[model samples]
Target chain A: MQNETADFEITLRPNTGWMQLDLKEIWSYRDLLFLLVWRDFVAKYKQTVLGPLWFIVQPLMMSVVFTVIFGNVAKLSTDGLPKMLFYLCGQLGWTYFAQNFNSNSATLVNNAGLFSKVYFPRLVVPLSSLISNLFTFCIQAATFLAFFAYYKYFLHTEGLRMDWRAVFLPLLVLQSAALSLGLGLLMSALTAKYRDLVHLSPLLIQLWMYATPVIIPLSEFPEKWRWVVALNPMTSIVESFRLMLLGAGTVEPLYLGLSVIFTLVVLVIGVLLFGKVEKTFVDTV
Target chain B: MSRPAIEVRNISKSYDLGSIGATSLKDELERLWKKVRGREVSARKGQFKALDDISFDVQPGQIVGIIGRNGAGKSTLLKILSHITEPTSGEIVLRGRVSSLLEVGMGFHPDLTGRENIFLNGAILGMKKAEIREKLDEIIAFAEVEKFIDTPVKRYSSGMYVRLAFAVAAHMEPEILILDEVLAVGDARFQEKCLKKIRAVAGGGRTVLMVSHNMSAVRSLCDHACVLHQGRLIQTGDPEECTETYLGIYHPTTESGVVDFKKPENETAWMKRARLYCDGQLGTQLEMGKPLSVEIDFESETEMEPGIGIVINGPEGAKILHASTRNAPSPSFRQPVKGGTIRCDFGEIPFTAGRYTLSFWFGGLSYDTHAEDPCFSFEVIERDLWGCARPYQAAHSILWWPAKFELQG
Candidate 1:
């Protein structure tokens, strides 16, 4: 026997491959992913004493931590904006990207039993994870919006300042998702090969948080070292969300445009790599 | 193989087991550096060839069983056929829809109910959504979980889980079905039903390729069998012939009708000897509804009372008859019985011919007396039936009926 794949010229019958990631099939299975997401959501809250309130409780707690550690303690300026809103904008972007990335990256390993026994484009697992993460991100975003509304009218401050830039916020959220999907797919493909990626991923994601402008504003960086921060793909994503939602900073068209281009490029390449790897990942995984 | 549905040509798979077993980060990193640049990279360490130069064809509407021991590459073959793992070399041309039941409930999410999972699992098995919708009721009915169809499958028993999984896979009606030891789940009764469903699926005229250690299942369902020993093809022919070959190849000491028992022989007030015969033939078939005799040779080394009897267990694990010589009035021959042979002949044999065993007791052991069963064995051949109402009783639980059968999906 040799180490070569046999692609016997089977009759060109239309199969799942022919279906070619048909969006219609995906739409039909959308319920499956929805239920899985709901299951995860419910299971998370089920035993927790706080229940679904944890969704609201989590970000609020994180907001307090950021306000103390970055705002009061470090005296990090939020571009003269309320510390809560400033961090909330960054938190939304960071939460969406990180949650989607972690879940999607582990999709293959998480369903290793299923993949070895059954055949479904293997892409479905990660895609399903992406959907669920989207749901979680939505919940968190809605909570943040509630906070934003309350701060705007009820608090009675310039904190209510309006900016037309917020309308592009959806695109920013979408870009974060695309970035996550790309990186997640790439890591998933690699993790199947190097299982060490399983242990390495979370630490890397945490370290990556520091590299991106997640906890602190990109403005706080030393002028000499700003270029490096600007180079991180997530740096622009975080900055874009802050600019769009908080209206605290001006958009660097070059950086934002570059982030968008990178997102599209990585998305295409990630999908291709994902497809190619899924063809025989069972062996390595 | 006629009009091959799945053809595997010159396929092989090799697995590299790195020097260290999988461990946590601390252990892996310590070894990763050593494993990467170490001399253990070649002959002494890395590769183990799981399958080598394996090739076979599964014809459309043909049921082929691949029989092998634990590591003789059965799984590797199924994996390649399903494209879950690509073959190391060569090519496989799959002609129709290929559904592999290598593991049941493979993609089922515990969060989903049986209804939702049927659709998800159907898609994973290669059925389109509309097709799954059409088969939903059939699947639910076949699984016999209608009451719990809308409830989460996590609440289902393991038997129910596999049943639902099998139902979904079967409903797909794939042109080809590849199963890998997935039938060992669920209750025995459910297993029987699953076999029936598989037969029905095959009756639909599609190809099936199965790998199972259970020789009975292979013999009952497969039209053709391929034997694999130590990662090489040993034989391919009728299921019975292939199984015999595979068994002989693996255990050289094994002989026809001679079970390899390790205990030393003993004959003490025990029916130490027994044999099954029909029409004075040895180790041969018996006709159903014919007079038959079971001879038991025992030793009354101690002494016997009125409760001593013989037990003849028929095929299908049925205890068909018990004849006792103990109850007979004391000695018509005017000789006290000690060690002697007793013969029991039935005016009519109710058993269908296949295989059965005989055992006896010095007293009513069924009601608590002393008796030892050497685990005797026997086979009942199909009654040579000619024309009208032959009174044929099948000795087996499930009949192969000798048809070249294939199960698709």
Candidate 2:
């Protein structure tokens, strides 16, 4: 028995500094992360009428409404791209970011019961949210592709060519995930202590969507005010998506570079804050 | 010497007595403003120490019980050990994989089927996916919910839910397992099975730390125990002595053999005082097989046929003896009268060494007037009733019965 104590597997202390991410611990709990993601995906469609079809139906409806209200009624510009295709691409990108952020922001409060009783990497919650929402984004993206192929190949619509730069779709998606996860981690940490953020989050996300090129093309905004959209960190990713897919939106290299840098910064700050808060959130939450 | 499986070094936890943090931005801004102005901030004024400078060590393969009254820091200490909450000061070193069952079915989603929950719950308890797959059949059979495995747990009866949850947790093989009174769930038969499972886990050279209010469970299951009182480790050693100390702390007695009840403000019947005596001397510690008597002094408003009764309960709250004046073959004070004093004497008591509580009640044929259940507590010390000149093992049985054996061949 004495020889058995040669290795101390874990040491728990009063404070582990703010920057100890413990990514190795998170990797060890990858199974739980997978199960949590599976749970979120499987549980959402349990009793729904259409099941996962709602994933496709949701963005489809949003695009139709945007094309009708913004394109026909409000008469917003879609550059040279078709209104439906323009809105669908924007909706798909924005939905991925919005959904991830929404779920991740509530991670701590919603799972407080489970969190208080178990010992697992708290970051697993937001990471799993990112993965599960990716599945929704995929389904919605497939729907958008069907419309894209119909307009480009089937109808031979004018100026509807897919550029080689469309290969950056995955990178854009990763950026969206990172940005949302970072913001979500920051919000979750804050909301655990000050729940006022809970009520403020939805409004924040809504106002944030208006500032991005979700319903209208960035080309439609005034040149002087375009930099305001560029500052959102999401604008460049959305514009890049439209640029590569529809070949209409602008992709300023400097703005895109700034967006990536800003995302990494938010993500670092978010991770640090989350790591600090997860240790004692059970007490305060 | 090998190192202890767990070394807790002066672990302490504190919390703000008021709100943990300002719930709104307005209040937070106000606090910041005060801090900026160098004014006193009230947030730091109310600090509560849940656990204070507590330390202990657990050896591998040892089953240790942590016993304490409510608000005694038992849960707080377990939370810190399990890493569910961080301690404000001090540290701990654990030599192996540690898993804590702070709650059963903690991560189970109601919408998920029982089968899915087993995997989910198993993963949450730190079992690898492959490990859970290996134990899936055993877990299902143990829970006896094979028929409902595919059904959503929301449809499970609470019994089935708990059974399934415990089954998943039981299969988790960790080097150090922390349990928090989770065995109190389920029926008696299931509880017995869970206890057996835990015992088997410790038998496999693993360490177990459990917090239980059930003293009998602690005594029977734990080889070593620690008694916590108000965030301090008051006692730690043999489970029997630790349990005794825990009971004493919970039910502190003033003096020894006498208990004085507060005088009732306006009552028809009330007990003023009660006393226990052994061998005509007032004492709470009674030797085994020694004669003891209880005396109660009371005053009543009515002159009716009053019946008085005394109940003696063993450490586990099991009734050891119940004597009633109404049941006496030849009743003293047969004539109905206002209460004054009543004494009941008995032959040698056969109770084994343990803490026992005494309760008294006074009533009439038509209606019971007043009763003080568990009015006071006393102890029964071991004595050689058989004249064998050897110490009796009191842990196995609650009673001592004298019997004669002769070699007739």
Candidate 3:
């Protein structure tokens, strides 16, 4: 048996300092993070007929709806890209962001029962949600890639050359995950004491979707309004995603760099607030 | 020797009595907007102190039991020590990995299989995956749920679920273990099994802190005990002595012989007040051979037939005597509106010397209209029983009935 005494010393205080990450303590409990992520991934599809396939089905079905409403009916410009590929590409990023944001925002309230009875890094709750949702996003992204290949090969669609800048796709995904996670943490912290955010966030996320270039390409925007739209942190990521995969949408490096900075700032604020609130969330929650 | 395994210094916890958190988004936003506009936000009301400057220490390789009535800050103290919640002010130092079991099945997901939940619950308690893996078989065997380990826990019976949850908690090999009333669950045999595990764990030189209402269990298991009354540490010493003191304080009878109901029974009828008298004078303590009278004051919103019963329980929780309206010739209510004082008079009290609590019931035959527990507690002191030379004792005795001895030709 390992002597636990040598492992760590614990001291509890009423208030956590303004910035106390306790990164080492969180690092040691990484196994717990893994379990939390696994429970979420498995329990989500346990009794469903489609099981984990719901991951692919959700994005696929939404893509069809977007293709009809935005592509055909509304005649939204896809930057000369095929309708299926264009909408699917946009839906993939939005799905990951929406899912991560929604679940992570609910971390504290949803797990109140577990939180009150045990002690672990409170950050693990939202972090695990981010990781678990990433798995679902990857599965859905695979389906998008399959559709992209079909359009490139059999149809040989025009203006559909894959750009080397596609390598930045990982960076784009990371930015979205970080931004969603940060915002979610902030919301969760506030929601612990004020539950109004729980009912209001889903509607807010829907409204935010139109602000980002999820359905319409950035190229379709008028020159004067472009700057205003670029202010949304997700806009640059979505535009860059399309530019890399379809070689059509604009990719301004400055805008993308600004989004990364925004993400980091939000993340810091979120973590600080979460750490402070988690110390006493059980009592209020 | 080494320092104590745990040290707590002047720990206190207080909660806001207001709407604790925002009930809805609208309320929260309004509060925020009011704050942003620099308006006076007078929503928050009062503060309730749950724990008040509580300090204690537990030495290495010793088991300490915390005994108290409900709402005595036992849970708050454990929550602070376990890091589940923070105290309002104070400090706690733990020497090693501390595992707290405030409840069974802290993270048992009904959708997950028993095997999966074991790992999940273990991790939730800060156990590493490798540690849980090593004790998997032992946990399963201890829970007696091996046959259903692969099945979803939702399919298992509530007992099975508790057993599995308890098994995982019990398997944790922490240097310091804190438990709170989780042993109250499960059957008698399982309870015995859990007690054995707790004893063996303590015997293995681990520091243990336990809070339970089971006085006998504490007496048999703990090396030392602490008694808490209204958030303050009133006593700490031998387990037996601590438990005795806790019971004494918890069942206190008012000096005025009036005990109010802790909670209303229902919309129909409830106990308002209760009092005791010895030989027609208001008093709490009764002489063993003197006349005793109990007065129960009650009220009823709607008129209904109600039966009143007075039950006496001894210090050890055994029923010593019972007097009910049911035994009377006209037990049912004589009128539609039945609300007043019902008195029970005893010519010669038969109880031996001991602390006893009075319980009452006011309801129909099938259901209790209203019931009060520990409504009034009084001490019975021994007195001479009409010139009997035999010595009288209270221990190991319930009642002393009058008997005569004679020599026959």
Candidate 4:
């Protein structure tokens, strides 16, 4: 049949432009993004002994462990704040980023079967994980607020106060999400080809948490090493989160600016790399 | 004239066969070392051209069949068309909302209920939430899983699971559909239903591209077909001719009436050789109503009594006859073990004049092993069994049956 080819809806070629992000296509698949998010939320807790309760229990347990090891045993500085509140607040931000990052990093490898057989926006997977992990973050944040309330009202612990900057909590969450997703996308793309990174990722994330001020506040680090920690995009987000909610840590404006810039750069690079990999990862993966 | 629904222009895909998934640091170091020493390194050496310079056009509402033997690049082409993988060279233009069913249940979670899976799978297949909701009841009814809609899919039988998955895929209303051997699953009746559903989809003026090894399905369902062979498009034309070409690729010329298979090194049981005889003479052509027999040689490692089977399939790969030693009323052979030859004699071959392939199966009571290929091929020549010189036409049936007609007067 002779017909005009200009009206073709899709043209698959050997080389697409490097900057072709296809954001409209991703937007068109918004319904799939929503369903994938819903699936993650519903399926994650299936057959669990405590169900979504594990969401709260996980961070609480991690906070207690951090309180015992870093706060009580090691007597690490908590920026003049109570150990439970300090670690819980830190856990609140760190858990969200780490959970999203871990899941997103495994997006390609874990869903290789699905990716091989279907065509949707590959970003939909990590983006849905970002949304799904936010649900967990909300529950953990509520748990942190309960502890913050107890220390502030009942215990009336010294130096514990919510400031006007607490409004920046949503911004901090967004920054943490961006950093996680960016790094996760980068890692997932590399791991699809390398596979060695799959084994190295968890260890890297663990070491990365130590580099950030998750267990101990940035104030406790040596002055010379402060710049190294500042280079980590997560450092300012975690510090600013504790500073806003607990009023115990110092937030440097320059480092906060640097964190934002770093996150944007990484996010752009991650999205681009992930886009490049998604097209051909079915063969390598 | 209407526009072509799909135009695949000189599409080719290649893979580094040696380096796929071999990305560990140690292997990289070894490869580097080999390269440094001027030794031939295989890591980047074996570039396999899976689909080489393949091109075709499909018009709207055309149910096109992609027929090929395994490793003939059928899957590579489908993957490229469906966007699961990218072609290394060339391009394709598609003029519709393309949906590919490379697998039936690509994203189904075992813990999710059938109803939930319907939504998830529908979304993965590019359907909007409203679309799935609109067809929810119809999907459930088609799958026949209404009673188990709310139950976890892992709890349902495999048949029900396949039914549900196919029902969800069948309900999708994409303008262009790419289907792999998805119809090869399910029972005969369900497969027939799926074929009918595909026909209905095509009847809606949508384009369908299907890759299937089932020659009968290809011939019956596809109006046009393309034959792929070793990463190349060898033939493209009418379905009947293309299917014949595809089948010919498998058994180009097996007129010797004898086949010898290499003995498997460590297999417990294996078929060794087979020979066909027409009227007690070694021949590849069997006349209708003439006596025919097949002699099979087999070997077993242990002292276990194993049964052997022979299957004759028509030119379109549809099974015509299956004769198994285990199904015989009396024990045909009482051999205990080792190696031997067993000859099966057919009283009178009743097949219509056509080419047929023969497949063999060897199995014991506990384990079964089948020969990977259809070991032999033979032709049945047309003959006038009655006193008249009139021959039976294949349009009537695949077999010739004798009948006596008498007037009641």
lDDT of each: 0.70, 0.87, 0.85, 0.87
Please identify model 3 stretches exceeding 4 Å from their true place: A1-7, B23-43, B253-307, B311-330, B335-355, B361-373, B378-409
In angstroms, the error of model 4 at B121 is: 0.5
Worst 10 residues of 3 chain B by lDDT: B329-338
Tell me, by TM-score, which candidate is best: 4
* Chain A alone, TM-score per model: 0.85, 0.96, 0.96, 0.95
List each candidate's DockQ score: 0.22, 0.48, 0.57, 0.58
lDDT of 4 by residue, B291-341 (tens): 889988888777767787888888767788988888888784666878788
- The per-candidate count of clashes, in order, stands at 13, 1, 2, 0
Q: In candidate 2, residue A145 scores what lDDT?
A: 89
**Candidate 4 wrong stretches, greater than 4 Å:** A1-8, B32-43, B255-275, B294-354, B359-372, B381-409
Q: What is the overall TM-score of model 3 with all chains considered together?
A: 0.87
TM-score of each: 0.72, 0.84, 0.87, 0.87
Off by over 4 Å in 1: A1-53, A261-280, B1-3, B17-46, B250-394, B397-409
Among all candidates shown, the one with the greatest DockQ: 4
State the lDDT of candidate 3 residue by residue for A1-285, as single tens digits: 436364557888877478868888888889999998999888988988989888888778888998899889999888888988888888776878888889988889998988988888888888888899889888988898899888889888877888998887888888889999999989888888778778888998999999988987887899889888898888888888888887878768788888889999998998888888888888876
**Model 4 error, position B403 (Å):** 14
Tens-digit per-residue lDDT, B318-377, candidate 2: 677888877777764657777777788977877788788887887775455778867688
